[model samples]
Target: MGSREWSIEKRSDSFKAEVLETLSETGCLSVIVLGASGDLAKKKTFPALFNLYRQGFLPADEVHIFGYARTKISDEELRNRLHGYLIQEKNPSPQHSEDLSKFLQLIKYVSGSYDTEEGFKRLDKEISQHEILKNSSEGSSRRLFYLALPPSVYPPVCKMIRKCCMNKSDLGGWTRIVVEKPFGKDLESAENLSAQIGELFDEPQIYRIDHYLGKELVQNLLVLRFANRFFLPLWNRDNIDNVQIVFREDFGTEGRGGYFDEYGIIRDIIQNHLLQVLCLVAMEKPVSLKPEHIRDEKVKVLQSVLPIKDEEVVLGQYHGYRDDPTVPDLSNTPTFASVVLRIHNERWEGVPFILKAGKALNSRKAEIRVQFKDVPGDIFKSKKQGRNEFVIRLQPSEAMYMKLTVKQPGLEMSTVQSELDLSYRQRYQDVAIPEAYERLILDTIRGDQQHFVRRDELRAAWEIFTPLLHRIDNGEIKPIPYRPGSRGPAEADELQAKAGYVQTHGYIWIPPTL
Candidate 1:
């Protein structure tokens, strides 16, 4: 996915030059999963690699996978476990059994502690041998270490990788690391973590993975906004009323209660995922589509966000959250939160950017709703129907639709809500949309930073929410309890209305029938 997405002709000459340079190093690729014994490695890490292998992106002759952890499992044991996980997720048949067998043959497991050099030494030896066998004296080598482990171990694990697992060949060889997030509890901790990792690797070689940025619709945003001329004049403050970025879940923190309790919905979802989406939605057009240029624009948007007002925030906890043994009886952590961020920049100044996320809600979906201002001096009285809304649904059923007022089909001069929809599944039924991880992992191999988060970009994001997060942690603000299968606290809706979001009633955009 990265190789294809990066090669688009729209890329800046500078960007193309940089990518071409990286492409020149046709080294053997080695993907090492640090916490290979964990659920994330089995479910997402290995499965994405398998998909890439079967798709021919990772040529069997050029790529090898090493799974490292302290589980002490044999190579065959790990492969067997992967076979089960892939079968479970991909279902009865994703590919022919022969292809599955060959893909599994590429994996080898090693037991290791995150902080120790002894294990890393052995891992390095294995990787060096593989590279030596695959490449000639003139050829380079490429190594990617995926830290599927916890953030606490990042520093030591990264240190070990730098010390023992760096590429052995200096013939244009490179080493890259992919780290997952909850970058930290707040600004201070995040910076500390960044400093630790920064000492071991350069920023260009570090990939901060945000799965949301890899979503197909999210990636389509720049193309939708910049490539189309129709939206140029209407995308700013004067024409747009409000923007809502929302995430919902129909189930509680069933097994992740312990982890979810520490961060809450604000840190877990709103601060990172929704915030990243907001940057793309509200940012001014970049100087060019180069990775650095695009990320610079994102940083500007984050820095421009004004401090959040208490009146514009609502936090809620589901009634059954405390029932989980891992959750404290008096926990103030919010399972649901609606926050309104106002950008200080001219283009988005008065418009409210409302971000909402919740667990155990009535439905499951993530979407961006851009509500357009009502028509001025309207003779048709379409404002009575509802404001025009452009919605981009990110999951469950990926789609984009525009809600507008039109005359009722027959004759009576009345306005009705209608939509122009592009439902991906319905429109492109034969094209398989690759998983988010698939694209990002591939991007790591190709050294594309357009979709990944940057250091200062991350710092700016943490600054916006850290003050509010600290307040939540100190119990100055508490969560209002709501029923499990509900739309969260009533206060959330009131806050939305207060922030100028007009809910369109009696209008739902149904996906077109196949």
Candidate 2:
């Protein structure tokens, strides 16, 4: 992507440079990669760190990586395992070689269980050996804890770290914790979970990760709204008909059947990430880009979200998670969920915020579609153009396009629907889009809390969904099953129909073909 098209401004080089300076001066020693042996660690987390190191965001020296897990693996074995996933180019440049070597030297592994005091002690000892620990004390020390384990382990792990390790440290900088998704099973649990984590760490220190927020297109929401004058006046309930957020996948749990059964689609997607994005697109502009300020506005927008009715929400499950031969079937798991939500704020009372997510259905795509209300009293057959949508595609490709009514060329006074597309590939054709984990990991070290989720925001989100979770658990709601590779349950369509909305086009972009 062009410097302008990317999340951080090209002119913000000054800001980024300032952040790097702060990080270096902060005397942070080593990054603790919790659940280091998990799938997230291998596939997303560590790769992101490596990318940041290669990009010069991380210090070449004095920075250590401690891989903490209960896998009982040797450092050599761990490095080799990590190396398998690390794609290194042949004939690396001298600079890259030097940086990689320095990074490797700082890397080590510690085996420990999240539930044990002994485990936390071992992790503490490993961290203390690093020079960063020697360099800063009390408030100035910088330690970033990345939790890549299952959500069930989050509270205990966080509590242990806080009680056993964090309290013992006198760091001058910061202590930041990054946890992965499935924040809670429902609203009340989410609140309780947030409360548990919040008690252990200050709001500023907790980073509840939603990989989507780290995405290039996702972060660009602010720039798309505030930086440009074309969208603001038009971005209100008056002009917009509805907003749709779709997080779809074509694959099932892939042996993660147990976890899928517990969280399902709503808790997995809508409760945190997708709702955060919708708020960003709909929120009033913050006075500055300060982390809390941006997050505050987002929280307000979410709080303004009207509680949804049973009829407006649709839940579905794929063929039983346990029934699949690859893994035990975990039935009664709603792998798919769709909801038509309304934000009761002045700017968006009537607009429907439609959210749909499912696994093992249709295709893999994550996008936000903003449908505009038709022009009133238009002479042209305006219903055709009434389907105008501003789509932000996140997966398979990162791009933005706006569907509008245009006069057909050489035609009998007719208007055709077409998109004003700005494909990221076509723009900056060669720049590699970094992974979410990489961007977020770098952000943690650099002290840019803008992209990470804060504790209050997490609590507010939970408050919005707690009732739905309770209803589902009480069997007041039943999941409507959809066939594999289909768009989702029939109820999903009915939910949209009730709101007078429809997907106007056949699948415009398909990932399998790509």
Candidate 3:
């Protein structure tokens, strides 16, 4: 599925001016993308950086860029490759030629395995040549290392950087590292990874990225709750009957089946992105927006997740991923999973938190639905009809809508559902949502760790699903069958049905169509 969450809007003139001012004052710079040639770097990173550069987020003459990868290519070839990925090539902007040339001047490529001492030395040497580093302000130039590589490569790379690249004794500013998702296979692994990486970099220096947190609406969660009077009062279990977090994708493994089949939906999405969203939705208010304060609340939410029973969870695999010509026949990996997680905290006690996510399913949708407790002793006689619901759609529609029963206009006191809607498109006319990558990349440079995941939060998330992963791997559980273009395996529906939840009759279910 296409990324539908973030869109880039030029920062207001004052904000842009402030960013420029900050860069000039700090003399910080980005460096040697760990997995420069990987999909994320090519498709997301480069485009985002280029956008920032094009928009003057960074001072062209002062900023420096570097690429590190094993593959060796001439500077010309590398520049051409990056251009193809970063731009449409044809019908380029009048400013494109100058911008690309300026960017290329800042960009450098060094080929070597990040684990080796030689590799790290080469990277350090290459970075030292950059104007930004050479002109360092009486200290080591502030450095940002973006690790876009796989999980397996993270620790070794960090160790190498610490051993061979970091100049802690130097007067230069501090070093910050950016890491991608799928932090580890489970809780133990996540902790191990964290501890190992911590040995090299302080917790403050390491930024664990969860791009979902960068979305405007996702960020709006805190503001929507605390900034407004309406949401917080109804946020608890006493008022809210149930909460559903659905992250659905339309595409299967595609050609990445070989790699993705090894780690199903739970490990791939729920553990990091989806769980981060859940925490934001369920977390207790922090005393302040300080990074640690916010993160402490998130970890508490994660820790509060009640142990999931096998019977309470359901798993499903798209049929095509197992036997279709496009995917390996032996693959039994699940593309979808749905589970009910309860939080033992007083605020959410006895309320079910339904978490469901999948790929190659009916549609591409990311949404959270909060079903409120039925209006106290409803005056209406109809028994099946329940109370109102509040939904936040993160993708496709990018809107918030609430369903409340209202009296029918006619003489009969019949009730009908009415939606109080806030459509992003209609409400925010001509405004673009910043791309997640852009916001995240910008945050890294600004040293804002509030939106990123922390080691403890990561471990807490993994703890919740570790048992489920082991069960799936050891053949202790069989995936319920679900067809393409369908909601999911019948078990998913039964899951809600058992909890007395039926899909509301006349509401729209919009997933990301792209």
Which candidate tops TM-score?
1
Off-target runs (Cα >4 Å) in candidate 3 are 1-11, 88-92, 96-101, 132-134, 168-172, 324-330, 380-386, 407-414, 509-514
**TM-scores, each model vs. reference:** 0.95, 0.90, 0.92
Candidate lDDT (C-alpha), each: 0.90, 0.78, 0.80
State the weakest 10-residue window (summed lDDT) of model 3.
Answer: 1-10
lDDT of 1 at 75: 97
Error of 1 at 486 (Å): 0.9
Clashes of 3: 9
lDDT of 2: 0.78
> Model 3 clash pairs?
7-433, 7-434, 7-435, 139-171, 139-172, 140-171, 140-172, 364-511, 364-512
Better of 1 and 3 by lDDT: 1
User: Candidate 1: minimum summed lDDT over ten consecutive residues — where?
Assistant: 4-13
Q: What tens digits encode model 3's per-residue C-alpha lDDT throughout 1-514?
A: 2233223233366678877777776555756687887888888888888888887886766677888888887666667788888664678887897787788777788888877899779888777667344576535476778998998889999998888777545564668899988788877878888989998888889999988998877988998888888777888977888888999998887778767877788888877777888899899999999988999999999999978898888899886776655556765577888888888998999888888999888778798888887666766853355558888998876988887777779998798777788888776655656778898888888778999988878888888899888888888887877888788898898998776565677545343232
Q: What TM-score should be assigned to candidate 1?
A: 0.95
